[model samples]
Target: MSTGPLNPETSTSLPSPPFVHLKGIPNFRDLGGYKVAGSDLIVRRGYAFRCGEPTSATPEAIETIRGLGINHIFDLRSLPEIQKMQVAGTGPKTVDWPGVTRVFTPVFREESYDPVSLAKRHADYQSEGSEGMVNAYRTILTEGANSYSIILRHILEDARRSKNTAETALIFHCTAGKDRTGVLGALLLSLCGVPDEVVAEEYNLTEAGLGEWTELLVQAVLKQGAASEEGARRMVGARKDSMINTLAMLRDEFGGPENYIVTKCGLTEAEVAEIRHFLVVGE
Candidate 1:
């Protein structure tokens, strides 16, 4: 995969189709077309996406999202974040995209860290360096297993009954789509037999997608009293090592993503098999 912004011209060569670009929506991509290791199977294209919050999605972008045939949207944002960003007069607790089912499965409680406070806290911790980021990722894995499990079950059940059509597409997102979304994307791909290196590479792509916004985010943090400019900059950027370390911890402590899902998330072996069956297509 090219380590740069997804170029539609050369998208044919990509592991997945070119990422869908929506004005004001960052870090959005089709999570398909990856070849499974040691097998002839590949993840089916157009069935799933990973993205950042679409609170600022333009009218055209909303149409584009609808056109993608996404019937299910798994929002991972805390309630406070949703309350703060949801468009007024649309609906309470959901984006007013007609014909789409939006599920609010927050990985973290609103009281733990709402979107407004998380940015400031992220800046503070990130200023200290990677340790803060590493700790955050660890917490997502250990403390957020129930939410992850719920997400997995939704995907599994959806895929199991899907007609293998684009209309069955599912997407999940957080505020920035770099941390929480990255972790879930990593977990899903890792569970499907993608190598850890490839998983980390995918996680790092968020930097390319969100590079401009990252600067703006860092500046916002600085204005809000980050300890240092350099620290805020470090916090705003994505690092392969952070995700690499998280995966390593998963391996060392839980055996692998499957085990973690089974033990931590309480998914059964049969359900895991069902998910693999629906997602991995042999060509």
Candidate 2:
């Protein structure tokens, strides 16, 4: 994996496919193709992607993505997330790409609100919807465990694609690809038998990988009249506490990661067995 901006010509030589970059889309890269769990085979290159709000994708950007043979698009943004961060352009609103599958994974919906906004704007989720936000958070406590199921669905689709020679790649994302996407990444890596430290390291990479961008985000926000350190802090982070908390939540609900998948995520042991059989590179 070349850890740099992918130039169209030089990218062909990359260990994994060159990262698919668009001027407007941030963090669009393959999560597969990394050395993990002692397997020579990694997640198939060009199969999985993590990106920020893609509403800004230009015609060229969409063309590049289409060229990558994306079979499915798993959108992790909440309804409000999409609305708030409206991509610059609009297209035929269809999840079904000509040869792809589209899935919407919303942790929070448009109606939900979190009073705490970034320090810069001093904005709150209040305008979005007060009770909806509270209800959404409560639902997370009670049903947050359900995300595992949604994730499993996407992976199963990936596994199925791998089995069939059809486009066997899937890309998933949330707004920043840090929290929602981060947890899903953690779950998948852990299931592949990657160590917690490795997972943590991968999670932490967000700060380094996105640090410059985070700074730019702060500057952009300030240019928009947001002047708060909290906003800046929020931009440059893989919040340790949030990561730890999510892990704790998983442990508390499911005896282990596997249990979380089978019991909580709606995957039977056999189903998970199928996923492992197809998706994992090595035993």
Candidate 3:
């Protein structure tokens, strides 16, 4: 309900202050220090991050990630997705940060795929159109809400365990850190009544920050005469209109993200309160 850019003075920039552009990771970024709507409360900087895997990152990039002071990681990749990346639990497995915990929450079970074929099938389906993307968002809002209870619980429990500590950060990721993670971020902020434009701005940053691999996906599709780079870009990117449609779907089907979580995902208001207490600072 409020309209204001996050204060320029308090905003931090490090070329990657909010995101270290790992060579292999597409659109990895810090989710921190944003002012919460209708209140002085802000989402604390460095307390949470979202990104793809770090397997192929250079040693310097790895150190840069460690220097972010991240103490917890929640990997949302399916088992096969991790295996295909071949970076599962490898290079950036665990930094020297004491008490760091790694938790795995597969967005889809391994059984959901016929390992040899599903990845390519997913890629083909995703390359299709507004419908595929819209359905993806709808699936996310409906089934994807289920993942939040676990993530929210981890955040709450981690914060409780780390009380009075210097700082703790949790990073959540699926393969691209775009669709699944993006939905989670959008829903959490929406529940707080963050304006649609602000939420869209954050969601669309993934496109602005896309690394070479993302570019390659666009190029590959273009080379095949499937679409122009511009068109392909549009296909892979999140758009405001699509988000609105997805919200409409949520409203019609689940009544909204918060209600979907409560009624469908089984997250009680008490748990939601604890999540707010732990993550949304100064509330």
Candidate 4:
């Protein structure tokens, strides 16, 4: 239950696991307990969470989420991904989090479902280990800035309205609760002064968070002779190095996450500070 600074870089810590293994909701977990760099502060638990599509969450799970004091549930899946898919996990989300407001926030704009492009991306994953995760991270932060900003602003505003960040906990997710969700998670952690490497490790935890869906995703990622089992696994899995490279890109290109959110996402300095303050606790 306790997770503090493991080191300045490299967040390989397991004093306790952080995932919430709710039935039917893969990768559902708390996004807290991270230690902030150069301080004794740790990110507050029960304040933020991440998960995959929750359409399959059981009623009991919905009740659990409701009791978590969640003020908003941000759905970051693209419209097509959320509304058009026929698959069980990838399809439109139908389960609601009790009475919590579900904000349909698509972090990606609609685009033609180009099979060739997706195949090429998978090929890139096989040929290249990181599968161009840096670019993907960058695209979501930049091109998807508006949607991300909305999520951030809403969290801050809701906290103001409720006058309690803990009661205003926000849960956000994409299809697998990794890629797009991972990027936003990293940003928030980094804003709380988490080291870049540790942030990457947080992003990397998605592999385990995906739980049994790992095989399903690997199978779905595999396309006729496109990649070996290992390669397809790599495509479906969240690599720490990919997230590390993404963190480096954020530092080298965007001057770390704080500046990126301010310059690109258009959040005011006070708003960003308030979010950081709420996230990190203990002096």
Candidate 5:
């Protein structure tokens, strides 16, 4: 149980210093080096990474991922999407990423991911704006804990066996790395004592990190769905107010992130503490 924050003066910004340019992987970034408000601690880098789908990852992209020493990947897409990715492979039709394990713990496991239904849902929210985001995130927080519990259990197990979390650093992502992945990132960063503002900022980076993929998605939604241009963009945009509202919901209704994990996610307090230690190491 480390109550102390990570000291950045003497520590590298990231566990794997010198960010490399990654091709074919959109919205990929290490979750580290962030200054938690009113503390000397920064979020430890390299232990966690958030990215978009990896099926389109190039061989060079795979090398960059391998270089991170990311031993595990948590995919938040449903069974249908996971099956599609397995057939899609890691870029080339048949290439597989050796050594690293890919785990599927779908955020919407039982719910069918039908394109017509998904489009209709987005169309239904065309005028809702941040309200839609707020409702969507609330559902994610309420029902998605079971999916997250799987990752947390693995993280605790790994932390118990080793002090160095970097050797076994892991990634978690959904298709666009925005909604489901953003909530997961926010929870992890909050547990590390990052401020709500900082958490929102980190979440908002999803669009920029998505780069070309962002526009492509917006176009696809506009063409295939009945959503307005704003609504189409909203589907991919990580507006700060949405996350702010979600964090407030997390605190007010869920009794804060820690309690949420302990009660809803089925993690013990001791396991949660160990995960915090593994994620935030002092210099």
Candidate 6:
């Protein structure tokens, strides 16, 4: 694995380049590049990434992900989703990269949201529109808090132990890489001191990044008679208002990301501090 920086000149003072594009992988991007609010720090690039399932990743794309030097992968997909990826021969397979450590942290369990139930849920999304998606986000925060807590703790521990090198980098993802991944990404950025607006903006980027696939997903839902065209669009697209409302809900219910992490997610204050300490870096 190459140990050098992907872009040596990139730093907190300068904007990072565009996300590394990997064919067959939707919504793949570094979690870096944002300047932490109220500090001279920035999220160190190449150390963290977020993406959709990689089951269909081309050989070249797989090589590219491998080249990212990721050591830990936190998969937030449901069991059915993971199985679909496995059966379809898409996404990252541990066998493909023996050196990487992959952890299956399904946000929704098999019994709770199996494939048939998930399909029904998607249909519900069609009628519910963005409101449905918002409710889903809430469910993730409330019901999936334990899974998220584990993910956050693992990331904190990895960041703490790693020497801040590419080889120690961590990547996390869900199926769409928007909803579940978005919420976790938002929380992490918020913990690193990024403002809610920036966090929402980052979340919104998924609409553009996954535009083509989003369209296909919406079409699929529509074809299944799960939702109206408008409903399907709302369900598949990543809207800023959805994240904005979710963050507001986070504040109203849990007081903010820190409180949510400590109270709802069961992370300690020290672990939270360690996250900021290890992930945020000064120029």
lDDT of candidates 1 onward, in order: 0.70, 0.53, 0.58, 0.69, 0.70, 0.68
TM-score of predicted structure 6: 0.83
Q: What is the lDDT for 158 in model 5?
A: 78
Question: Candidate 6: lDDT of 179?
Answer: 78
Count of clashing residue pairs in every prediction: 0, 2, 0, 0, 1, 6
Q: Candidate 5: give the clashing pairs.
A: 6-41
State residue 155's C-alpha deviation in candidate 1, in Å.
1.2
Please estimate how well model 1 matches the true structure, expressed as its whole-model Cα lDDT: 0.70
Mark the 10 consecutive residues where model 4 has the least summed lDDT. Answer: 1-10
Evaluate model 4: give its TM-score: 0.86
- TM accuracy, model 1: 0.83
In model 6, which regions exceed 4 Å deviation?
1-18, 84-96, 111-119, 122-130, 163-167
lDDT of 4 at 203: 80
lDDT of candidate 1 over 2-113, digit per residue (tens):
1112211112223334377776566688877787899888877777888766655667777887888887788877776665542121223455677778887788767324
User: Candidates 3 and 5: which is better by TM-score?
Assistant: 5
- Candidate 3 has what TM-score? 0.75
lDDT tens digits, residue span 159-238, model 4:
57655346567788876777788888988898888887788788877777665566665665554344677776666678
Minimum summed lDDT over a 10-residue window in model 6 is located at 1-10
Give per-residue CA lDDT, model 2, range 1-283, as digits (tens). Answer: 1111221111222233434546556656666554556556554455567765555456666777788777677776666545444222132232344666677756555432211123222343122223322232234434445654776776786677567343566677665555566777777766666656666666665554443445554454444444355644543356444454455555665565777777667788877876755655531
Worst-scoring 10-residue span by lDDT in model 3: 1-10
How much is the lDDT of residue 41 in candidate 5? Answer: 70
Please identify which of the two predictions, 1 or 3, would achieve the higher TM-score against the true structure: 1
Candidate 6 pairs with clashing backbones: 54-90, 54-91, 55-90, 55-91, 56-90, 56-91
Q: Point out the higher-scoring one by TM-score: 4 or 6.
A: 4
The full ranking of all candidates by lDDT, starting with the best, is 5, 1, 4, 6, 3, 2
